[model samples]
Target: IMLVSVTERTREIGIRLAIGALEREVLLQFLIEAMVLSSFGGLVGIALATAASLALAHAMQLPYLFNLQINLVAFFFSAALGVIFGYFPARRAARLNPIEALRHE
Candidate 1:
């Protein structure tokens, strides 16, 4: 997805670079974008899981335990995964040749 996004935004990125945006700036932009997307997904998943667990436990007459530590860890892992996976495409965008990218149709 990141790769496709970067591809689709080639012209925009090229314009940014042409207008003096630094590589690190472009990298950070995409990295943050990815992290935000993944973090939102993780939060939704956490909410659903918590709701389902509580509902199931109640249905079965079992104690429902909410583990903040576990959820926080999962969120951290999710964000980390985003950074790891996002780096490649972000790097590709950062390293793009502005002239060539701008020429892209």
Candidate 2:
């Protein structure tokens, strides 16, 4: 996904690098984008799970258990995974030759 994003934005990345944007800055930008995407997905997943869990619990006459700590941990884990997985593509983008990227259609 990250790679595809990088590929899609090749011209933008090229322009940024050409305009003297630091490689680290470009890398961080991609990483932050990935984190945001993952966090949003995680939040949605949590909400859906909670709703289903609640419905099932109610049907079974059981108490719905909501654990904040567990949710927080899962959220953080997902964000971390995003960063870890995104690093490679971010690095690739950062290392791109400005001239080559700019030539990309």
Count of backbone collisions within predicted model 2: 0
Clash pairs, candidate 1, are none
Q: Give the TM-score of candidate 1.
A: 0.97
**Per-prediction backbone clash count:** 0, 0
Per-candidate TM-score against the hidden true structure: 0.97, 0.98
lDDT of 2 by residue, 1-97 (tens): 9999999999999999999999999999999999999988889988998999999999999999999999998899889989999999999999999
Candidate 1 residues 1-105, lDDT tens each?
899999999999999999999999999999999998888889999999999999999999999999999999989888888899999999999999999999997
How high a TM-score does candidate 2 get? 0.98
User: What stretches of model 2 exceed 4 Å from their correct place?
Assistant: none
Clashing pairs in 2: none
Residue 19's C-alpha lDDT in candidate 2? 97
